[model samples]
Target: MSESLGDPASAEMNATAPETFRARFETSRGTFVVESNRAWSPNGVDRFYNLVRGGFFNDVRFFRVIAGFMAQFGINGDPVIQGSWRDANIPDDPVLMGNTRGRVSFATAGPNTRSTQLFINFGDNSRLDEMGFSPIGEVIEGMEVVDALYSGYGEGAPNGNGPSQGRIQAEGNAYLEADFPSLDYIERATLVGEN
Candidate 1:
């Protein structure tokens, strides 16, 4: 049977992830692997795991690729999917690790606001730990590919010229393809060992 794809509030979306597992992300640039440890952040890991299993990251853009900083993505390109997850907030996972280079953590608006967006640190961003950015995993392979993802767009709108998150959520990839055509995107993402 196919895996059930549901909103975060549903039981299928909340199913527990493995104690340790790897997720392979195939992007426009190349493929990379992130091995997540549930012990570090169970809630965050489970959400990420289910999203991959449910094929949620297909065609998602690396919208905010900050050179020498991090590459952020995970916003669904389908506005319908985006709307379903917009208010599906998950409580903050107590940060158990620092935001070192290659570490992955969910992006948040504030406390308990983490939903789908996440970033991969390109440098030591330990300072984020103090602000509650709990890392669920780190890139275990193809760090160079992660390093090479296009970053010419810089920061998101109002601050810089990159695509605005609100617009991406509202208009989906149509807005991105028209305005920011050079952005690299995830072709697909998958669990490493799932049958």
Candidate 2:
């Protein structure tokens, strides 16, 4: 049978991972976790998709929090941060996936330029896929955690002061807010078995 989002059989097919990873995020405010069981190809065209599914960089921070728009994470600037592995950039995987809601995709500046930055989709963003955004997985649980981030124009925000204006910079730079709620942290992430 063909895979359909509504079918339980299809859901299992969508979770195409050999193992499961649980990302445990520890923020000053509280802890949050994201679970997954999908794998991405390391050297294949779907490499970017795989990294997000592989749980390779679990425990990364939700470095960027924008209220109402999205809460972004997946970059561990701190060397001491657990699961922060030093690795080279992976090739781009733009043509194979999309930026669907609850879907996870790598953040990029240009083509073939993804290091370790990733974000979860709060809503449908089809425009990003054409721009090279690759969806790896969907938020199986705790999406409410993903949606509760404090939204605002972060320090050095390019969009000025706006509700939808929030930015999480590449290369390990976090937002200016010292203490806030609605911000989520990936407490643990692991890859389970694929269908």
Candidate 3:
């Protein structure tokens, strides 16, 4: 991993991404490929491309996988690196595509909160379109691997038996390793052609 991704606010993330590209993810469960279309969500695609190329998703846990819904992840395992991105939010993109099964979108708390977190829809979640969640890509290979990610811990804090995002941010993987040992994680993720 390079230092470039450690600083999410860097200008490098602002460059527009390719018209279309593929990211291959090798995970604890297996492998999957996501094909991102810049036209779908330019800013989101650019941020994702930079992150994938700079190796930010390595060792990141699939922290929030919900059955029949989506698999969410993308918090950096190192708290220091994660902290650097805390305020690096991006503007929301228009929903150009439906959030159907296999669609990938950034997770947001509200308007324009997309930073590092992303989710892959497991079912038709088109209802989220009105909520401003734009689909930047779709899983083009090994969707089964995504579906196989552990979801035993349901939703995070104040919801179900999952680890708290607050604790994950503060304590890094230590909190997750101690509490959510069975969580699946990305071994490494990289831009397909570059690697």
Candidate 4:
């Protein structure tokens, strides 16, 4: 097995190496691909490249899927990894692109808080662009699969019926499967050019 992102040994790995890449996600809903341009959001793109190459997104649940809004994920399956990355934030990227439909951006609590969480916009969310949500990539294929992901739980935490981030980081997928059983998940995420 590969080292989990939460493993302290791997946590310190640099994600800043500049590289343009494409990622393919095999999900319970279906498969989709995202092509990232390094220049769009250097730090965000690099972090995502590292995560995808590290197998960090495998078996991760789509914890926050709000219809007509966005679908969010990136909490690792291992609680340890989830905890390790909770504060492993990267610097914010200037909002060079609008959060239009199919665009993917890092999810942040505030400025420079982007860690592992990412969301794919379901519609034109241009408002988020002004709020500093820089898109790292856009879905190049199978966007319908993204749209079809389960959203029955709505937003997360104290606002909606979805699972809590705290619980997810503490208990991992066990909590999600037991509580949000219908949620779609990433079975695996792979770099497009890799074997």
Most accurate candidate by TM-score: 3
Off by over 4 Å in 2: 1-59, 77-87, 153-183, 191-195
Q: On a 0 to 100 scale, what is the lDDT of residue 143 in model 3?
A: 99
For model 1, residues 145-194, the per-residue Cα lDDT tens digits are 99999999999998998999999999999999999999999998989976
> All predictions: root-mean-square deviation over Cα?
1.4, 10.4, 0.9, 1.7
Q: Model 1 clash pairs?
A: none
List residue ranges in candidate 3 displaced over 4 A: none
Q: Across residues 46-102, which tens digit of lDDT does each residue of candidate 2 receive?
A: 333244345434444565554534456655433433123334356765346556666
lDDT of 3 by residue, 1-195 (tens): 876777676777556788999999999999999999999999899989988988889999999999999999989999999999877899999999999999999999999899999999999999999999999999999999999999999999978889889888888889889999999999999999776
TM-scores for every predicted model: 0.96, 0.57, 0.97, 0.94
Best by lDDT: 3
lDDT of 4 by residue, 139-182 (tens): 99999999999999998888888999989999999999998899
Whose lDDT is higher: candidate 3's or candidate 4's? 3
lDDT of 4 at 14: 58
Q: Give per-candidate clash totals.
A: 0, 26, 0, 1
Q: How far is 90's C-alpha from truth in model 3 (Å)?
A: 0.5
Model 1 score (lDDT)? 0.91
Worst 10 residues of 4 by lDDT: 8-17
What is candidate 4's local distance difference test score?
A: 0.89
**In model 4, which runs have C-alpha deviations exceeding 4 angstroms?**
7-12, 15-19
Q: Is candidate 2 or candidate 3 better by lDDT?
A: 3
